[model samples]
Target: MTEAPAPATPAQGGEGLGDKGLSGKSLADHLREIEFDPRMIGMVAALAVIWLGFDGLSGGAFLTPRNLWNLLVQSASISVMACGMVLVIVTRNIDLSVGSMLGFVSMVVGLIQVRLLPELWGFEHPATWIVSLVAAVALGGVIGLLQGALIAWLAIPSFIVTLGGLLVWRGAAWWVTQGQTIAPMDSRFRPLGGGIEGAIGTSASWAIGWAICATIAVGSVVARRRRRRFGFSLRPLWADVAIAALGCGAVVATVMVANAYALPAGIARRLTEARGQVWPEGGLVIGHGLAVPVLLALAVGVAITFLATRLRFGRYVFAIGGNPEAAQLSGVNTRKVVMLVYGLMGALVGISACIATARLNAATNSAGALDELYVIAAAVIGGTSLAGGVGTIAGAMLGALVMQSLQSGMVLIGVDTPLQNIVVGLVLVIAVWLDGLYRKRLG
Candidate 1:
């Protein structure tokens, strides 16, 4: 009898082998198949290139502690809102009203500090920062809940509702202030705009440097453990370690550079001599250092990351985003989830508004004028899919930074305001288009 034909080995495994042909592939080969998209890689690389170009043109000042700090602070509000926006977008929904909502909340916060608190409770300490923050955040949550109900319970399309809200809220903001601007914030609230930590001078920088390192280390460890526990695939340990190390190095380097700034050198020394009499003296130093916005962004990022990765709500969010019907079928409270997402978005916008108010030291009826565009653009640029079900807080933050950096750089380089606006609009369109293209490629 003819012997049974030799069983095919992996190399001769029919179609599977045909796919590989003469190419040898190890386990790493399988990993490569599921690697990050090329477009994503290219986008990130492009950002690096732009940053480098700007750095060169600005003679390294562009990347200075002061500038970097400013960039961070400027991006913070957007980044925070983007976190919630990602959740909303992941659910295959959009909220066009966030900018207006944010404006309204900022105005409310200012109004509370100026008129409401004093009127409502007969207390005029002039230090209503904490109270204003609480009221603003609450206002955001309430708005979110209402919108969520309209969308989830009433089945109203998010686009229409939020768009209407955009108009309504902005109108309300203007009405609240009677078209007057609110300014002259409390001294207690000033630091949120741009404050320092540490003993000022060199020690302050070291303190901040260590803080960043610690944060990165803790975050990396927590993330790695969570991914492992959840049975999610992860980058190699080496990769993780490298990222953490690199982040720490970057922070330290940035702080050192910021401390070298003329502003920091003099101010830090003064702050140091004062012996903790003041807040730390470093935030976003041009060419180096941290910015309040950056710190705020980092804080928001960490919070959202934990919420997304470490909580059941986050898992449901991803689930809903990926397949709402399936998620609902699986007994997930789809309505509650939707409401929660809107609420969270509202809260984020509110927080962002507070930051914006602090930054500007005023609540303009235009506090968040047309900000929805930038928020959406940043999220898309940072790899958040418009189709939903995929996004990262880190990506959103980075995207905002990229956008803000481009704007700031253009201004510094003397590109006219109109040209800057045109370029930014184009960038937003390109980013969204690229995201769509990337999704199609993935599909």
Candidate 2:
């Protein structure tokens, strides 16, 4: 029988191609690819430019250390929630209940501090602070577990379940507080969320935070190499090194900038008089440190990144997102995965509530109000796809920072809160639309 034309060789594969005479692939194709959503990157870049432009117009005061640290603390709650939201969204689901859950947790914790802790079933202990925290977190976890089970095992739509949770949790929160505010937590607890570590000029805690970020960055690079080796994939060493170094540099810059503001006026004068003599007994110190919350958030971020990037569970998460059917065929327990993701999100919200409560020094009935929108916006704006399957902790953090900066900067610039809300809402719509457009292009 007459044979068809012979198959083309790799060299001959490009013969019919125009100009470059190159194949479809290149050396870069074998490297670890860029993982961020394009829409996210664009939004982040735009927000960053706006932040810097505004700071410049404001005579550089907006970029001070105090302001930066404030920004980090404010962003932390949303960023943590966004990380978990990323997982939920990747599974093609949304958790509208997070805000109510947060509020519930906040109210529960506040009550523990104010009422529950003091009345311990009959007897009271002066050491109720620890008990209160544990109980608050446990309750949060339990709620999440129940909701996750309902969504995963019961096969109820996440929308309905979480919507129910939103209403239920809000009522529970109001019930717990009787529509009143709880305040004046223990001094010890305050420091955990609001206390500074180090002298006025140098926050040792912020330094530690940067150190943790560096460690995480290094660990990520090594883990990436190991993954490539195991997958039998080829990657250029230089690229990994470059990426790792860039990450470290960014962390250092953030920490440094957040601590680089002028020492408070009192500290400055003391340092001037001391002329660098032993900090002049509380003179403006170079090492006056940062708030404890900043460090706590950094530590949390590092741990989450490690879990998401370097673990088998994390791999399953991405696989399930990429294609649930394929992942199921490959032996992944899709139901369990979904349950675990929601549970994890619940735990994160619990922790976020603790931090927010501590920072506010009270859990008002309005705690976590409207926070869900901001948290979700941060994730989507940072590049988490609402349709599921792709996201990063770093991207979520960046997104949170961008959102917080915009809000804070707007207020600093005399923009009304109503206008700010309108702006953020518009940005959210634009981001989602852009994401949809990119998906269409890819399809």
Candidate 3:
């Protein structure tokens, strides 16, 4: 009798052993088509490299719990602004005036909080903060609206409009402040920036971290269920589990680091003295958990992501960026969409200004100088396309973190200021160049 021939494997055109057949395409093709977001993966790897590089140079000080916590806090403003900038870029528009807008709005906030409210009422007005917050955000939006209108209705290029606003707003800020600094910001506002006196404590940190993880898991489950109801392809169960597990791990790691550096020496001593207790030889009190500004950034990121991914407006943005004529033909109201994008950006600018001013506990004429460059770099480095129709809030957040980490690491490594700027500028250029090459490949 002739020996039985063995069945061919997947490579030989037969399905692989125990193939599920759920994937309609051939195994190889299915593997190739599997969804994977490279931007975030690359960002995480880049961040890891930065941490390792800086740790080595700083003798491990760079990754210390305190330093890492401080890093997150410091990056919060840039991160918040980047969230809004993502939408702007996705619509194929750029706002060079964000830095100037921030400075100008911050001065307005300062005038209300430090001078106008107090001087008018002789004592801090009870409702000053409430009114100031509204006014700041609204004023920023109006500025953006005017600039966007010029671009949309008058046929002015966005670059030109925002560039003009950049000069105009900065000059306005300088004139308002007269080159002076405004200080003694509101008590309630300080905590929003995660100042030393107003950060979350240890318990709250862990709670917030775990809560975030839980919320993400729930959101994932809901999304999966909705997709299934619509008969969309669902990822394997293992993938969902793995993703949730990774998110939990990340949150736990962040909380652990913050806990490790709970209290600094001076703060510990003050606590001990206040409690009338003898301080231990080298022990420090646990100061606090995650900073408030980090939480603010997280909240803003969540809101922006929802707006971008779940709304018709966001869909219109991508459509317009991809093909303005087609989008207009589809009744997308291209001009209004672009205008709303810039308007939203202005509001975010106001928010970022508030955060930065609170952190410094002062608003200076130069508070946001060069910040527009940093914000744009964050969005680009986070994987936003300059040509539009591509970006994510998550990517922008990670990009802001990367930029801040580089700056902080450089400071620790004692790199010269000029050299640092040169390095950052090169990174931005390289990022844009790589993106261009990527688009060319697709073409």
**Which candidate ranks first by lDDT, i.e. highest?**
3
Better of 1 and 2 by lDDT: 1
The lDDT of each candidate is 0.77, 0.74, 0.84
Error of 1 at 65 (Å): 2.9
lDDT of 1 by residue, 387-408 (tens): 8898887788778888988988
Scored by TM-score, the top model is 3
Stretches > 4 Å off in candidate 2: 1-44, 119-129, 195-203, 206-210, 213-237, 261-283, 286-288, 438-443
lDDT of 3 by residue, 73-186 (tens): 999999999998998898888999999999999998998888888888754566776667777789889998888899888879899999999999999999887978899888
Q: Candidate 2's residue-wise lDDT over 44-142, tens digit each?
A: 577779778769877786877767777777887888888888878887788889899999998988887777666655333546656666776677778
Which regions of candidate 1 fall more than 4 Å away from where they truly are? 1-43, 57-61, 117-127, 195-205, 215-237, 262-289, 436-443
What are the C-alpha RMSDs, in order, of all predicted structures?
6.1, 6.0, 6.2
RMSD of model 3, in Å? 6.2
lDDT winner between 2 and 3, please give it.
Answer: 3
Candidate 2 C-alpha error for residue 49, in Å: 0.8
Ranking by TM-score: 3, 1, 2
